[model samples]
Target: MRRLAFAILGLFLAAQGQAQSIVPAPPQVAAEAFILVDAATGFVIASEKPDAALPPASLTKLMTSYVLANEIAEGRLSRDEQVVVSENSWSQNPVFNGSSLMWIEPGKDVTIGELERGIVIASGNDATVAVAEHIAGSEEAFAELMNQHAERLGLSNSHFMNSHGLPDPNHYTTARDLAKLSAAIIREFPEHYARYKELDYTYNDIKQYNRNKLLREDPSVDGLKTGYTSEAGYGLVASAKRGDMRLISVVLGTSSPTARKNETRSLLNYGFRFYETARLLDAGEELEKPRVWKGQVDYAPVGVLDEIVLTLPRGKRQQVEQRVALVDDIEAPLAVGDSVGTLTLLLDGELLYQGPVVALEAVAPGGFFARLWDIILMWLASLFGG
Candidate 1:
C-alpha cells in the first residue's frame, strides 16, 4: 500500500487578529454536495458534505482513467495496443440501463487510445469495460486496482466496485476525493488530459459530444467528466483555469444534468472570483546551501521536493511570507532526498502550509585529513556560539 508521503514541518506563526472577509459566502447550490479546491495547492476554498460517500455515477471513470494513465506511464500498457470488446462489455443487463455508450460491436478490436476518447468524450460504458478487461482481465479485478489506488490517494470516504459506474451499493466517492483525483490526473498525466477538452468524438460513423456542458458554456473550463444514473443524480467533476490559477469543482447528486453543470459552474466561478494561488518555490529551486562537515563536497544544496504553491484571498497575495529552519549542522553521508530542514508559509501571522526541505544531491565522506579539519572547525564554531 504505497502512500503519498511528505515530511511534516511544525508551524510556529502566531495568530493575529481575525482575518478580514476576503471572499464572500459561497453561492447556495442545488446539488446534494460540492467542493472547490486549488489544483496546485490542494487547498479547499469552500465545501459542503465533501466527505459524504454518495453514488458517484459515471464520475467513477476518473479513477478508471487514472489507472489507465498510470499503466501507460509505467510502461505496462500502450495506447496503440488493440483491445477486443467482450460480450459482457457490450450487453447492458435487463436490470441495468446504462447511460451513454461507444456502441462497440462484440468481438470488435479497438485501440486503447480510441477507447480512452470514447470514455472521455462519449462517456462510453462499453469502451470503459473493454479497457478494463484488456488491462486487468475482468471488471472485478480492475476494481481491486481502483480501490488500491483510491486508498493510496488517501480517499478515506471513497470506494470502487466496477469500472463503469453502473449503480452498486459499494461503489461510491466523495466530492473532495473526486477533486483530488482530477488534480492528480491533470498534474501527473498532462498528455492524456487533453482528451478531456475534446468536445465531439466519432466512432463507427456515430458522433457524440461530451456531456460536461461547462466546456462549451465557459472557455476557462477545460477537461473533466459528468455522470448520471437513477440512483446517482446528475454529477460532474469539472476543472477550469484563469491565468496561472487552476481550480477543480465537484458537484454530486443533482436533480438534472443542467443543474449539475450549473452548480459546478457556480463553484468554479466563486473560486476564481474570490481565491488566487501563487507559486512560492519551484521544484529543485535551491533554498539553502549549507556547509557539510567531512564530505566529498563542502556544501549541500537543499530545496522543497515539489513546487510550493499557496491559495489565498483574491487580494492577499502580497501578504504571504515564508521562512526555513535548517538543521544546526549538516554532516556527511547525506542522501539525495533526505529531509534536513523545514519550510513554513505564513500570512497575516497565521500559518498557511509547511513541508520538508530535502537535500538536492548526495554527499559522501571526505578524505581523512579533510574530515579531521572539519571536525576541529565544527568544535571551534560551537565554542564561539556560531
Candidate 2:
C-alpha cells in the first residue's frame, strides 16, 4: 500500500510569528474519579482513574432512563402512553422513605413521559419503579434489559441491579462508563434528554427541582443528572456546549453537593480552556479514488463513513495533518462500505480521528477478459516491484 500525506485545508491555522500559548497543565479536581470528553469525537481530554467501578447512587437512573429511551425509540412505548402505577411503586412505600420520590399514586393516570420527567428531574425512585414495572414486568427484569444496553453501549464496567439506583453491592459503574452513557442520551434521545434541564417539575401538586445544580449555574449546561447516597457520595454528570464544541464532564465520589458541582465545573472549565473541537471532514466528501483490480470499474470511490471530528490542544489545531494509506492492488468485488484505506488525523502524538476509509460505491467483478488483463498487469507491476 502507498500512503499520502497532506494538510487539512480551510480549518483554523496559526499565522506565522503569532503569539505562542502553551496549554496549561490540567487542573487538579477533588473527586474519586472524573473525566472530560468532547461529545462529538468522544475524545478524553482529561481523566483520573475514570475506570474505577464504584457505587453510582441515582446516577444509575441514567441507565434506567436509557432503557426507557430505547423502548420509545423502537416503538414499543410512547411518551404519552399511560402506565398504571402499582402498589409497590407508590410514593409512600417504606422501602423509599428517605430517597427521592415523584409522589406517584397507584393509578392509571400517569404516562411513561411523566415518569421520565420524574426520574430525571425529580430523581424519583417511585417514578423509576413505575416505568420499570410497566416496561419489564419488574425491576429485576428491567435490570437485565439495562445490562443488555450497557453491553451494547460498551459500558464495560457498569452493571445494573435495580431501576432506582438506591444502592446495592453489585450495582456500580465507572466515571468513564457514565460519561459514555450521558453522551449517548444527549445524542440519541434528545426528546427525553430535554427532560433533564427542567429546573422544577410538578406532580400531584408537589413541586420538585432538578438535582443537577449546574443546569441552573451554567447557561451553557443544559441537561444531565446528579446523585447522592451515603455510600456513593455526591456525583454529577454534566454536558455543556460552547461555540462549536460540546463536552461531557463526570465527577463521582465527591464530598458534597457543592463539591460535586464545583469539581464538575472545574473539569469543564479546564477542558474548554485547554482544548478545541472541529470537524475535519464531512461524510461522503471524497478523499480518494483508487484503482480497483478485477472489477467492472477500474476505480472505487473512498471516503469516511461519518463526519470526522477532532479535539486538540489550543493553538495546535493548525498543525494537524491528514494521511490516507491506500490499498495498492485492491481486488474486487468490493462492497459499498468496504474499507478502502486507513485515514488518520495527526497533531503531535494525538490523532484525534482514526477511522476506516470506506468505498463510497460498490465495484462488481469484471468480465473474464478484463479480469485476465488486470491480473497480467498486476503481475507485471509486481515483477518490476511497482
Candidate 3:
C-alpha cells in the first residue's frame, strides 16, 4: 500500500460563506403516508408514515409495468409482438364499476408497446392483464413475477397479488417502497420511462388522459404513475428532474387524485429548496500517482472504482471535507483494481461516507538490482521505524 493517494487529509473549504439556516420543516400533507427522496443519492429528504403498509391501489401497476419492460429489455419479449386479450382481463375493464381501461376487446390482438403505453398512461387494467397473460400465461403467475421484482428491488414492505392494482388486502406497498421502486424504474429504463410522460393515450378510439396531473402543472415533472381505488383512496409515485438533480415523491392514501398530486408537489418543492445533490468524483479518475517499490513502473495510479455523489442540506456543502488513507509503501506485482486505500468523506467534520480506493493500473516486479535496492530500503526503513 503506497501512502500515495487515498488519504482523508484536507480541510477543503470552498464556496461562499453562506450562513447555515434550519431547513424549513416538512409540510403537513393530506396523505396518510408519503415520502420524498433524492434520486441520485437515494437520500430520504422527508417522510411521514412512509413505511406504513397500505393498499397500493393502482400503484401496483408500477411493478407490473416494470416487469414487462424488463422482459423487453432482456430480449425475452418484444414490444411489437402481438398478445391476445383474454376474457378475464376484459372483465376487469371499464364495462364494470368504472375501471380504467384501454377498452381492449376479449380475444383481440394488441402489441406489447401499445399495452405498455396503456398501462403507464391510461392505467388500463385490461391492457395490464393482457400483457400479464402474454408474459406469464395467467394473472396469478404474473403477480409472482411482480413479487420477484419487488424482492429484487429490496422492497421489504411491499407485496403484490395482481397485475393491475385492484384492491386486495394482500396486495399493498408503502410510500417509501413505492418511491424506491419508481426510482429503480426511472434509473434502470430511461427509454421505457418516457412513456409515463404521455399526456393522453388512445386505444380503440377511446382517449384517456394520463392520471398523473403534475406533468400538466409542473414543467419539471416528467414521469411516474398515479393510483386510486375506493379502499386505497389516491396514491402517486412521481419523479421530477431539475438540472442534474432528480427527486422522487410518493403520496399514499390521499382523499383524491388532486390531493396526491398536491402533496407530491409540496414534497418535491421542499426537497429542491432545502437540499442539493452534487457529484463529487467520477469512477476511475486518477487521484494520485505514487512511487512503488521494486516495480517495473516507478509509480502506480490509484482512484475510486465507483462515482461519488452527495446530498446535503442546502448551503451546508461548503463545510464538507475529504481525506485519503493509504499504506506506507506500495510493493511490486500489484494488480489493477486491487484495493489500495480508503477515501473518507465528511460534512462539517461528521463522517458521511467511506469507500475503497483501488489501483488504476497494474505494477509488475522490477529488475533484480531494483528489487535488491528496494529490499535494502525496506529493511532500512523498518530499522528507522518507518
> Best candidate per TM-score, number?
3
Q: What clash pairs does model 3 have?
A: 6-324, 6-325, 7-323, 7-324, 7-325, 8-323, 8-324, 9-323
For each candidate in turn, the TM-score is: 0.82, 0.88, 0.93
Summarize candidate 1's per-residue lDDT along 1-386 as a digit string, tens digits.
Answer: 11122322233333477355467799998888999999988999889999998989889999999999999999999999988877777746432354688878776678999899988889888888888999999989999999999999888899899988988898899999999899999999999899999999999899999988889999999989999998998999999999999999999999998888888888898999888897767888887787888999999898877887788888676556667778787888899889887887777679988788789999999999999999999899879976
Q: How accurate is candidate 2 locally (lDDT)?
A: 0.88
Candidate No. with top lDDT? 2
Candidate 3 Cα misplacement greater than 4 A, ranges: 1-11, 14-18, 91-96
- Residue 108, candidate 2: Cα error in Å is 7.0
Candidate 2's C-alpha runs over 4 A off are 1-21, 290-301, 330-335, 349-353, 363-386
Q: Per-residue lDDT for 1-386 in model 2, tens only? A: 47564547456455677765588777899999999999988999889999999999999999999999989999999989998989999999999999999999985599888899999999999999999999999989999999999999999999889998888999999999999999999999998888888999998999998888888889999979999899999999999999888999999999999999998898898888888897778888788788889999987788887887777777776677787887677888988889877888777547556788889988999999999999999999999987
lDDT of 3 at 304: 83
| True-structure RMSD, every candidate | 5.9, 2.8, 2.5
- The weakest ten consecutive residues by lDDT in model 1 span 1-10
Arranged by TM-score, best first: 3, 2, 1
Tell me the tens digit of each residue's lDDT in model 3 across 173-288: 89989988998999889999999999998888888999898999999999899888889998889899987789999988889877888888988999998888977778787778
Error of 3 at 99 (Å): 1.9
Candidate 2 at 85: error in angstroms? 2.8
lDDT of each: 0.86, 0.88, 0.85
